[model samples]
Target: MDLRVLEYFLMAAEEGSITHASELLHVSQPTVSRQLIELEKELGKTLFTRTHKNVSLTQEGLLFRETAREILALYQKAMRENTGAETLAGDIYLGMGETGSVVFLMEQIAVFRERHPGVHFHLISENADRICEDIEKGLLDVGFIMRKANPLTFEILEMGLRETWGLLVPEGHPLENATSVTGKQLRREKLILPENSFFQSELLRYLGAGAQERVGATYNLIYNAFPLAKASRELIVCLGYPGERQGGLIFIPFANGKDAYASLIWKKRPVQNPALAAFLEHIGHTVSE
Candidate 1:
């Protein structure tokens, strides 16, 4: 298949009309339509469905669209790398969990910006499993995850920080005065927890038996639970309690000694973007020092 024809297909897919794609590509409508037909024959897939008014992708077309976009992005990236641009410039997609060690990662990013101002960072905060999912799908280049990741899939770098688990409750609650809490105490109240399936299982195991039934709600972002927690008596159990109390909530550490550590990970790629490679090298040198 021709690269130019792939662009024509992508344009038509985006614009939803062969005439619109022809206008954008500065080609005749018949030319664009002919190329699309040839592309379908070459791939043996009906990439689009047409109506009198417009066009849309089929299920196979949707899947192919995603793959084609990634291919174009990578091809452009390779060309940029070979062109020998003096300054490093590209987007770094990173996913992470909420951990105190993120401050350390930010510090590295801060210093890295001084040398290569052209580099940009995109950060997504999520649990270990979701982070790993995005990395495996090639959507993310790196992730800062809490707890151990699958060694078979990632090149892991231990971040050397541990996060203590704790409960967040309204101020003046009975548990507020306690230095630490126990599994039995955690079971006594309606609990708000993280929505990650793997982490939920870990929490259940840590809390021992009978704690799962007390779960009141689960949240993707911990902050979203705070409003509900303030409005009611529900208590949230989470890691790395915030230093400054907010919304009249108090954080008390768990007494049972369960804690989680942070790790930086990426898919074991044979080749990586120069910008990403530079950032990883910077992290290594900074950590060693």
Candidate 2:
């Protein structure tokens, strides 16, 4: 029931003998046996079968062994991060709005891991709103979102030095040749759109006000843009990204450059986790260069 008991049970299972488990745990053999018995009693199942010569796990024991391992792994990671080992090793739960910036993050993470082997990451990708909400709830320690998002609940770590958002297009699309197009040209085609955020509403307002009509097809997120556009080579998706240089689709820069504003968000307080701090530093460096 207690974590300490689970630790003892897991150690006993791993070492395969009370004597060895006690030696590794730096406790007496009887202490190890007593704790293991207490653990089995609490679980209401036999964790091991022991004899004069050998010890082995029962069916329940095997299952518990894996669960114990997972629990211990998480605990160890948390303790290390909380204790400042995060400078050299820790885990970070990060969220980002899907963008080509992920490739950039990956590159920096690879370098960070090589330099400091102790740090690990569990990264999630989502649209900007959810990223902010998760950070507020502590599900994420740090996040990335469109720079113009309301940041009353979070802190902006960096701003306005990211890549341009471009159009997602199919081959042979007419606008492919154009470097930038007006809101008038965009409304004439099927455009992929984001949800009802300030980003989307503001862009639509500018496009419609500029051209006096709707601009392209509407969708919830940039990823949704791909599916709608894929069906028709004639359909073009207007999205924000460091869009592909050249490919199945065209990357048309936004004329007003409205799509380029995105920022990194996190709780307004200093992050207590060392791994997160280091990771944030690495990302900041990557953003700068």
Candidate 3:
């Protein structure tokens, strides 16, 4: 049906007379009456009973009135939300430090998609250190990294949030029974350390010089770490706790070392695009939870 006809029908229903509806709609009474007739024909039912003092809707007309109002309201809301109304609706570029963390990002991104279906997401993944650097270079709108960064250019949403880093032991390992493995316990087993010198250096600092020398450190990815850890009963791997893992690997807390949580980074500058900022905020809230 024509939108003009629907408007005419609504106005006539509201004003209780075609003459008033014509005045309100800036149309002739005959024009208003014609549109109402067209609307009634399209709907296959009479909408109103006209009297000299009042106009009353039929039961079907009353129900159709509610439906029309709801449809118009939803259409208007979509138009407002999709346009520049301080609501986020556009593309967002998000980078993840760890591939394992993508699962969490995907869940949050899914909600964002539902709320703003028009928006597009461009996602990338890399090492934690690289993510921080990208966040510094202004290439990424937001990022999640394993290490803490204090870059002046980018604002941190999740600083010092890495609440725990733990030892990753393959399932069925004996040390799984222990509450927390100490440096002394580490000395007795083969160890899988991070491939990055920065993480290795930090682990050494956390372990002290003497104990650090005994454990074997590898500059390999976590996927490799799983196999190496599983091959040897005594080989223990270190990783951020609650990290992504295959079914074979079991993560346990370490006696030493503070949290190895990933931090969130976004542009420090005033956000030019509300959509991107909203997405960044959503991601921040998700990580916090």
Best-fitting candidate, scored by lDDT: 1
Model 2 lDDT-worst window of ten: 234-243
Look at candidate 1 and give me any clashing residue pairs: none
TM-score, each model? 0.77, 0.62, 0.58
Question: Comparing candidate 2 with candidate 3, which one achieves the higher lDDT?
Answer: 2
lDDT of 3 at 103: 59
lDDT of 3 by residue, 1-289 (tens): 6667767777777788889889999999888888787788888998898787567778777767645543554554567777847444555667774434455667878998888787788787666666666655544567876766677766776543444556777767776666676666665566677665667777767665475666664734466556666676545455555543464776677776566665667757542355665677777676667
List lDDT for all candidates, in order.
0.81, 0.67, 0.66
lDDT of 1 by residue, 1-289 (tens): 6778878888998799999999999999999999988888889999899998678888777767656655665676778779965677766888987656788899889999899998899999877788998787666789997878888999988867788888887887888788788887876788898988878898888887878898989987777888999887888888865343656778778887678888889888666766787899999777767
Ranking by TM-score: 1, 2, 3
- lDDT tens per residue, model 2, 1-289: 6787777786776677878888888889888788888888888999799998557888778767656654665676678768866436555677876666556567777998998887677788777777877666555667766555456767676654466655666766777778777777766655556553645666667667533243446554456566557675544434445446434666777787755555777776533455666677877777777
Two-way TM-score contest, 1 vs 2, winner: 1
CA lDDT, candidate 3, residue 23: 93
Clash-forming residue pairs, model 2: 89-118, 89-119, 147-262, 165-241, 169-249, 191-216, 191-217
